[model samples]
Target: MASMARNPLPGTIRKDGRRAFYVYLSPPLIRELKKAALDEERPAYELVEEAVEALLKSRRIARPATDGVA
Candidate 1:
Protein backbone atom coordinates (compact mmCIF):
# COMPACT_ATOMS: atom_id res chain seq x y z
CA MET A 1 0.00 0.00 0.00
CA ALA A 2 2.92 2.34 -0.51
CA SER A 3 0.91 4.05 -3.14
CA MET A 4 -1.84 4.62 -0.66
CA ALA A 5 0.61 6.05 1.85
CA ARG A 6 2.17 8.34 -0.71
CA ASN A 7 -1.09 9.43 -2.25
CA PRO A 8 -4.21 8.71 -0.31
CA LEU A 9 -6.71 9.28 -3.03
CA PRO A 10 -10.17 10.59 -2.22
CA GLY A 11 -11.70 7.25 -3.19
CA THR A 12 -9.73 5.30 -0.63
CA ILE A 13 -11.09 4.35 2.81
CA ARG A 14 -14.52 3.59 1.52
CA LYS A 15 -17.60 4.37 3.59
CA ASP A 16 -17.78 0.75 4.67
CA GLY A 17 -14.22 0.83 6.00
CA ARG A 18 -12.59 -1.02 3.20
CA ARG A 19 -9.66 -0.23 0.93
CA ALA A 20 -9.16 -1.78 -2.46
CA PHE A 21 -5.75 -3.33 -2.92
CA TYR A 22 -4.48 -6.35 -4.74
CA VAL A 23 -1.64 -8.77 -4.21
CA TYR A 24 -0.27 -11.32 -6.59
CA LEU A 25 0.94 -14.18 -4.48
CA SER A 26 2.93 -17.11 -5.60
CA PRO A 27 0.82 -20.27 -5.51
CA PRO A 28 2.67 -21.66 -2.53
CA LEU A 29 2.05 -18.54 -0.49
CA ILE A 30 -1.62 -18.66 -1.31
CA ARG A 31 -1.83 -22.23 -0.16
CA GLU A 32 0.02 -21.45 3.02
CA LEU A 33 -2.28 -18.59 3.93
CA LYS A 34 -5.32 -20.73 3.20
CA LYS A 35 -4.00 -23.59 5.28
CA ALA A 36 -3.20 -21.24 8.14
CA ALA A 37 -6.68 -19.82 8.10
CA LEU A 38 -8.19 -23.27 8.09
CA ASP A 39 -5.93 -24.53 10.85
CA GLU A 40 -6.76 -21.53 13.02
CA GLU A 41 -10.48 -21.88 12.32
CA ARG A 42 -10.74 -18.31 11.14
CA PRO A 43 -11.82 -16.65 7.98
CA ALA A 44 -9.09 -15.94 5.45
CA TYR A 45 -9.90 -12.28 5.46
CA GLU A 46 -9.32 -12.10 9.21
CA LEU A 47 -5.94 -13.76 8.83
CA VAL A 48 -5.01 -11.38 6.07
CA GLU A 49 -6.16 -8.44 8.14
CA GLU A 50 -3.90 -9.54 10.94
CA ALA A 51 -0.97 -9.69 8.56
CA VAL A 52 -1.68 -6.27 7.10
CA GLU A 53 -2.12 -4.82 10.59
CA ALA A 54 1.21 -6.29 11.62
CA LEU A 55 2.91 -4.77 8.62
CA LEU A 56 1.39 -1.40 9.42
CA LYS A 57 2.49 -1.63 13.04
CA SER A 58 6.05 -2.36 11.97
CA ARG A 59 6.23 1.24 10.68
CA ARG A 60 8.33 0.18 7.74
CA ILE A 61 7.90 2.46 4.81
CA ALA A 62 6.70 0.43 1.83
CA ARG A 63 9.00 0.60 -1.12
CA PRO A 64 7.98 1.34 -4.64
CA ALA A 65 7.11 -1.51 -6.93
CA THR A 66 9.74 -2.87 -9.28
CA ASP A 67 9.12 -5.21 -12.19
CA GLY A 68 5.44 -5.05 -11.21
CA VAL A 69 5.91 -6.67 -7.85
CA ALA A 70 6.21 -5.16 -4.35
Candidate 2:
Protein backbone atom coordinates (compact mmCIF):
# COMPACT_ATOMS: atom_id res chain seq x y z
CA MET A 1 0.00 0.00 0.00
CA ALA A 2 1.11 3.53 -0.68
CA SER A 3 2.15 5.63 2.32
CA MET A 4 -0.20 8.43 3.32
CA ALA A 5 2.47 10.93 4.21
CA ARG A 6 2.28 14.51 2.94
CA ASN A 7 4.96 16.05 0.78
CA PRO A 8 8.06 17.05 2.74
CA LEU A 9 8.55 20.34 0.90
CA PRO A 10 6.52 23.51 1.38
CA GLY A 11 3.89 23.86 -1.29
CA THR A 12 4.25 26.10 -4.33
CA ILE A 13 4.27 29.84 -4.04
CA ARG A 14 1.28 31.64 -5.48
CA LYS A 15 1.37 34.43 -8.03
CA ASP A 16 0.77 36.79 -5.11
CA GLY A 17 3.90 35.37 -3.38
CA ARG A 18 2.11 33.36 -0.69
CA ARG A 19 3.28 29.85 0.09
CA ALA A 20 1.43 27.11 1.86
CA PHE A 21 2.66 25.78 5.22
CA TYR A 22 1.22 23.41 7.75
CA VAL A 23 -0.50 24.43 10.96
CA TYR A 24 -1.92 22.04 13.50
CA LEU A 25 -4.79 23.06 15.77
CA SER A 26 -7.00 21.15 18.13
CA PRO A 27 -10.43 20.02 16.90
CA PRO A 28 -12.27 22.57 19.06
CA LEU A 29 -10.06 25.36 17.77
CA ILE A 30 -10.76 24.27 14.21
CA ARG A 31 -14.50 24.44 14.86
CA GLU A 32 -14.18 27.86 16.44
CA LEU A 33 -12.26 29.17 13.45
CA LYS A 34 -14.91 27.87 11.08
CA LYS A 35 -17.65 29.43 13.15
CA ALA A 36 -15.90 32.81 13.27
CA ALA A 37 -15.25 32.72 9.53
CA LEU A 38 -18.92 32.04 8.84
CA ASP A 39 -20.11 34.69 11.27
CA GLU A 40 -17.83 37.31 9.76
CA GLU A 41 -18.38 36.17 6.16
CA ARG A 42 -14.65 35.98 5.58
CA PRO A 43 -12.24 33.25 4.71
CA ALA A 44 -10.71 31.38 7.64
CA TYR A 45 -7.22 32.13 6.35
CA GLU A 46 -7.87 35.87 6.66
CA LEU A 47 -8.74 35.44 10.33
CA VAL A 48 -5.66 33.28 10.89
CA GLU A 49 -3.45 35.86 9.18
CA GLU A 50 -4.95 38.66 11.26
CA ALA A 51 -4.25 36.72 14.44
CA VAL A 52 -0.69 36.05 13.34
CA GLU A 53 -0.10 39.71 12.46
CA ALA A 54 -1.32 40.70 15.92
CA LEU A 55 1.02 38.18 17.49
CA LEU A 56 3.97 39.53 15.55
CA LYS A 57 3.06 43.06 16.54
CA SER A 58 2.98 42.01 20.19
CA ARG A 59 6.52 40.69 19.73
CA ARG A 60 7.62 43.96 18.10
CA ILE A 61 8.31 42.29 14.77
CA ALA A 62 7.41 44.53 11.88
CA ARG A 63 5.52 43.22 8.90
CA PRO A 64 6.04 44.60 5.43
CA ALA A 65 3.46 47.02 4.12
CA THR A 66 0.84 45.24 2.02
CA ASP A 67 -0.66 48.27 0.31
CA GLY A 68 -1.21 47.77 -3.40
CA VAL A 69 1.18 49.01 -6.12
CA ALA A 70 3.94 46.52 -5.65
Give the alpha-carbon lDDT of every model. Answer: 0.81, 0.77
- Where does candidate 1 have its weakest 10-residue lDDT segment? 57-66
Task: Give stretches of model 1 more than 4 Å off.
Answer: 1-16, 60-70
Question: Alpha-carbon error at 67 in model 1, in Å?
Answer: 31
The TM-score of predicted model 2 comes to 0.66
Off by over 4 Å in 2: 1-11, 61-70
Candidate 1, residues 27-55, lDDT tens digits: the string is: 99999999999999998778998998888
- TM-score of each candidate? 0.55, 0.66
Clashing pairs in 2: none
